[model samples]
Target: MSSAYDMIPVLSCENIDKEYVTERTWNGKTKTIFKAVENISLYINEGETLGIVGESGSGKSTIGDILGNLKSQTRGKVFYRGQDVAEMDEESFRKYRKNVQFIFQDPKGSMNPYYSVLEIIGEPLKMLGITDDEEVIERKVLGIMDKVGLSKSVLNKRPDSLSGGQCQRVAIARALVVRPEIIICDEPVSALDVSVQAQILNLLKDLQEEMDIAYLFISHDIGVVNYISNRIVVMNKGHIVEMGRANVVFANPKDEYTRKLVECSFVN
Candidate 1:
């Protein structure tokens, strides 16, 4: 029989807290400690999309950064495949980084202005030492670009030259180039137009099915989150007030905050 340890989520955290200490009035005499995320625990199953929804300053992005390891929590443990991230050796951490990727909200701002689309997409391969051969990198970049529905004609173009939808597609291509096991998507489609948003969402859904990848999708829009996620986590003031299957959470939200969000989503 398999041990209980063998069934842990792909990525998870327990009672994680993130705090920032700053001067109250910039004079250095008075100080204030801000708790961006507090006592939050959550997980992402393999090949599943777990959506986290909250308003601005609700600490949703803070949790995403902590899970992505871009920022560390003040207290608590982060696990990857049931292994503690804090105790990982350099090689193990490198492996963790290779398996976890991020797709940010602003596609144009996330990319370098000078780099071509090919360069932007292939940069991760070089950073992770996946390959040094230009031909191999180009082939992989081209393949991923095609998979994300981008044409090869724009291979040498810069992010500034592309539309919002196209830039987001390039961002998706960059994240998928490494074939990561989990992707942290932080409001990835919120910057695009309504029509374009649906296209990108559909693309993400198709890619998830084809790649068998798990997603930690963080957004403030309940409607968007409900559409993409298999499970939902509702956050308010750095705490998860409710969590369950997507349909169930929306249909019967227990928390007042979650109900307000669901109501707002419907009204909008």
Candidate 2:
């Protein structure tokens, strides 16, 4: 018998296209339509990581936003567990929101400065109707904090008082508090020190194995993406130029853009 990992995809998109309309006054007043992502299709299996890599302004975050349901696609459909996200009822959508969470790159900016560590991490559980009891919430929050390797001493402290790595661990704890099935990690470790980046990456890997969660890991660093992803999707100017297993794509990129990216990774 097939397990959950072998069942339907945890999240997927079909023929996705996203457009941004802008008014430009460079020469004269004119409307410009920019395709941030075009005809992108991919899936993330249960407990698997799918890395999306591209340079800045390559539409990596645009695709992540659509998949996380933080934004809707201009065209095509998004599916969660084979159900159309657009067609879901409010109740279903709420469940989807609880099941799929997003981890933003800027940990400090993503969190409210006023809320303490406990409040920041426990917010999701409260929103998901977990419980109103403070003791229960604290217990669950502490458990997740430990899992993320965060110290309980910082529980009452604010985000401003934490280091970059600590802030990120808090962010991860917040996402994990909901026990989400899939996480859209948008350049999660891009803003940290190299040593801290490795620590966060290892923590994420350990958590994935422990919790059986799936990830759509979005990043611009080819080396970092290759280290963490099972498969890779190479995006270029709003298009998926190349895609394959992580090792295969890194060893032998097919598209010109992908080749350039591989070469640039070495040069950097």
**TM-scores for all candidates?**
0.95, 0.95
lDDT (tens digit, per residue) of candidate 2 on 119-166: 999998888887888999999999999999999999999999999999
| Model 2 TM-score (2 dp) | 0.95
**What's the lDDT for all of these models?**
0.93, 0.93
**Candidate 2, residue 28: lDDT:** 62
